[model samples]
Target: MRRADEKDDDHVTELVSRAEQALDELIKDIEALVRLESPSSDLDALRRSADLVTEIGTRYLGVGPERIEIDGRPHLAWRLGDGPRRVIVLAHHDTVWPVGSWGDDPWSLVDGVIRGPGCFDMITGILQAMLGIRLLVEDGVDVDGLTLLVTADEEIGSPTSRALIESEAQGCTAAFVLEASGPGGALKTERKGTSNYFVNVVGRAAHAGLEPEKGVNAGVELAHQVLAINTLGDPDLGTTVTPTVLSAGTTTNTVPAKARISVDVRVRTIDEQQRVDEDFGRLHAVLPGAVLEVEGGPNRPPLQASASQDLFARAQELAAAAGLDALESIAVGGASDGNFTAGVGIPTLDGLGAVGGGAHADDEHVIVDRIPGRTALLAILIKDQLSA
Candidate 1:
């Protein structure tokens, strides 16, 4: 009974001690994961990433290769030990940057920073979970049940992967999403749901030099749609519509007959989604040529504050006990696979990834020195949560 009164860090130190010895293997694992070019929409890249993940899962976590397919990609799940409480450690094998989108060679650790596609948003989080699970197993700490889920469609709003995430999360006790934390490494608490919509316009075409009245410019029609979307911006409500990509011309002389604009939407609540729908619908009335077709919805379920404060309070307590300077946090708008498990009624923690910048840009890099600390933090969290 006296043991139950002890502190979480008492168990944390032992797990960290063992994990410290696995640093080299951890780096190797991260490098290998980053090397696989698994853009969520690319079939070949998804296959390669799946094979690597399955190999590791089978070799270390005691999970087999065969996975039930949901959206034509393998949603690999592995676990160790069984207890009444089941928690999912969520991450994505898919990357936002596709093959050839980065530097000449996108794989390798340069001065401790692993450079490659999918390193931050978020293959590194996946590695952290793998190593954390390994450390827990080595320490003989029996967590109720830990399910590590790596999916292939998180980068593209998870349309093909959402059903599988929900199914896997059905009876789990809690989840920890591995999305990158805040700019300064603070963890995430609440996140707004996101959507990607498309608007297409069609107009008559004629020779600009010969017949001016005979032609209608599709680009001009698309411009009207863009302006309509701009009017929906509510910065106060965290609702926004950004028309990020547009294509409208085949040649300089021709009046464009077709144009398409891709819009990215973010909403903090379900009610905001309705507002976005209403706002977007107005585009057709303003521009009759616009044959807008919206696709994708609610990428990440708004990561509502945990129903029970025990989960967040417990996490804050553990971090404090572990000697982290302070329990830092802020609500973010980004989504992660963890959102799925938590949305399905599991207590989910997030922002457990390597400290880094340039996640989806050319300058993407990880803080080399922070690897050990982040790895140590994860090891501690697992042990603290599972220790009886």
Candidate 2:
């Protein structure tokens, strides 16, 4: 067993070199993908993107992906190998930026950088995952089982696709999310969970000029609740309660009958999640004759450190073996499909995508030279996990 393990490691090390050699083809793959603008709300655009992915998967894996449509948006899934042990590669094709936002041309390769609406945020990672699997298959590496899931609605908080993602994650040994890396190529071992709330205040409306004294002001009540909600943030615990969107009043003059406020809650732990949930639930309308109702909580649970440490350690080892810089793990406030998998007790490693900045920004782009190394790192980790 030891001898076979050593042989597999050597093979994987060589496979890393092979991955580097395949850089040109991989870059073209990424360019092709980034050119397709698949916004979360655009079903036609997302389907077109899915078609491209299906073509690529069929060309390399000899089997196309299974398309799953949720609320008219399409998601793709490809299962490779039939071994009992399974690993999932979680990715999304939807980008936050809309089309034509990248100026005249969204797809431009300039001096070792690819800039576009979705280039760095995740198109690169999606391609890298395909390339990694291609390399593994072409090399005849022993892969137990691998599932590649590309969803279409992640950018807008994954409202429709969380069930599908969690279902696929049920028995997987590990999961890897291909979200773009942070500055300087940092991976993510922990991510804060997002608990969103829609706080609605209902109060009696009366004419401002005619019967102002009879009106119960919902807007004023919402103001007080907003202040209380803002106070829920604790910098020490990395918990924040921010009211992002507020809507009130049918007209400016009347004391608004209904006021709605959206609260964004982020927490670093499940304990914090519960605390915030309970606290938010306990909130009551301060003003007499007004009622407060809170809806929605914890869209994605935190990818706790304990659930990711082992996978992150393995990633670091593989990075070192591939002659790359030591991989660092971080805790980010933004959540991913990784949060779902980790929340379900799967060891999940995240941010294994291209090394770049400007996710969801017009300047969004990926470091061109880093693609091969990142792809190789993922290939090595997948190969190593299969060996184990």
- Model 1 over residues 37-142: C-alpha lDDT tens digits? 7887787778888888888767666656346577577778775566544666778888878677865677867777777787877877777778777766766677
TM-scores for every candidate against the unseen true structure: 0.87, 0.95
Off by over 4 Å in 1: 1-7, 70-72, 81-85, 100-105, 108-112, 287-297, 306-310, 379-388
Summarize candidate 2's per-residue lDDT along 1-388 as a digit string, tens digits: 4776577567666766777787787778777877778787778888898898888768767788889988888889887777664889999998887666666667888898888888887998998898888888888886658889999999888998899999988888889899999789999889999999999999989999999879889999999999999898888999999999998889977988999999999999999999999999899999989999899988899999999999998888767655667898788989999999998899999999989888887678898778777877888888777777
Error of 2 at 50 (Å): 1.1
Local error of candidate 1 at residue 292 (angstroms): 5.0
Error of 2 at 280 (Å): 1.3
Least lDDT summed over 10 consecutive residues: which range in candidate 1?
285-294
The candidate scoring highest on lDDT is 2
Which stretches of candidate 2 lie above 4 Å from their native place?
Answer: 1-13
